[model samples]
Target: MLRAYQFRLYPNKEQQSYFANYFGSVRFIYNQMLADKIDHYKKTGKMLKNTPAQYKEEFLFLKDVDSLALANAQLNLEKAYKNFFREKSVGFPKFKTKHKSKASYTTNNQSGNIRIEDGKIKLPKIGFVTIKQHRDFDGVIKSCTISMNKAGKYFISILVEQETPEWLPAEHKIGIDLGLSDFAITTNDSDESVKYANPKCLDRSEKKIKKAQRALSRKQKRSKNQEKARLVLAKK
Candidate 1:
């Protein structure tokens, strides 16, 4: 069985720069490969065979980042193409842009290249980075994905292969009724009912959200202040 655990990441200045490079390189490779495939299909009516190594010579900066990260980008593009071809409802792979695309990259574990030690995680080419691992699990590392959210928070999701635990058979079943006012109501075999209150999350933070939105709206378009305000609003 494969399970994923996510933790917050804290990288130093240099490591953060490396992360930016990795993110850009992965996005660049995916978009470039997608373009090549589209052009090849248009000209020859066949798919093109391309690899990250082929472009390393032309784009020397790509060599600075993790090679496995770039390879994963190729795999992601291939998967997208396969999905589109397999089902028309699945749209064709679109070119990734810096502003709109997700800021993330996945790299596989090879011979224990990815691992956690102490309170840090070791990544390919990026060295050890501090991680807020709230829980512990025993498994073999398979892969890890690094991502940055709109609020500029960094995270790492580690995928691991582990033995599935055996679950005991249930002695009794409980009936659950869900509603808007109350989150859930449950009745067990004894017919005793319990209600869980709905924590109106939006109601709790409505003022803060509106204030952030107003601050975002007041900022000038394409300015640094606006970007900061946008990030604040995203956090809200």
Candidate 2:
């Protein structure tokens, strides 16, 4: 089994520029490959094959328009297309935005330097990137995926291969039914007292949300008042 880990990279101004260039190069490759597919299909009535060697050949032409960093970025584009065709994954490779989420581009892990030491990890184009170490894992890392959450936090998810034991105990088995009013009822104890976390907090929040929604409904769409009302509702 394969798993991925994501880690945050704190690049300086110069490194940021390098990252931007690499990102732009990968985006261009993705768009070009997409266009290439469309053009080939229109002429041959067939989808183009996605192979590493095939993409490597296409990347050779990028020499006229880009340098080694740009050429290296195409590796990710190739993997993207490979996954798209092989796994039937949605969302084909596309151009990236300036302020996009984490994972601007992916490249080969040639450096053999995945862990952060001295509060930093060395990166291509970018020098050592500062990172706060989270929980550590014990296993051979298979892949690393870097991403950003909605709250603007950078995370590194490290994928590793691990073996887990399966449990096959038949001594304790019970059927349970769950409902809105009652949480659950076990077959062994039909009349057992069900545990319930008081719903007073939930009811209070629901009432506040309802009030905010009603206020928002009264406001006209696209109006400043409507926007304010929307914020209130969202907060609720």
Candidate 3:
């Protein structure tokens, strides 16, 4: 079985700069590869052929084109293409933007170590990333992908291969009905448990929001009062 472990990264100034550059370079490479693939398909009506040596040569070309190491990045790019072709994702790999909410990178299994130790991890180009290690990972680390979220937080995802536990056959099955005032009512049980709320807060919030919206509608458009009302309503 294979699963992924996502962790947070804390890189220094230099490391951050390196990752930024590396991420842009990889995006460029993926776009170029995508264009190359399209051109190849158009010319021959089949996929283009490239040996591992050719990929290695192209990987080495990063030195003359840009700074920082780009080894094994090609393999990940290739894998990304394979996944895209297989329809695992919506679209193929494309260029990245700095101002975007999620902007970061990935490294293949080769050319680097995605080692984990004592609730921390070490990534290529980006060093020593700390995380809240929830459980022990008993497997081989395959790949690591780094990215930021809409909340402006960085995360490192590690893919690993391991054996999954076997599931037991179902002995019996039962259905329970959930209610607002009551949590659930089982077919075999007569009593109901008060485990969940009746969503009173949501109704209160909706009513308050409607009141703010009504107040905003009373103000004339393009006026300062209208803008202030809009801001106040938005905060609701």
Candidate that would win on TM-score: 1
lDDT of 2 by residue, 42-95 (tens): 899787754333454656644433234344455666677668767775666665
Candidate 3: residue 105 Cα off by (Å): 2.8
Off by over 4 Å in 2: 6-14, 46-103, 148-153, 163-236
* Candidate 3: pairs in clash: none
* TM-score, model 2 to reference: 0.52
Comparing 1 and 3 by TM-score, which wins?
1
Give the alpha carbon lDDT tens digit for every residue of 78-107 in model 1: 999989989989898999999899999999
TM-score, model 3 to reference: 0.58
Worst 10 contiguous positions by lDDT, candidate 1: 198-207
**Winner on TM-score (2 vs 3):** 3
Clashes of each: 0, 13, 0
As a TM-score, model 1 comes out at 0.94
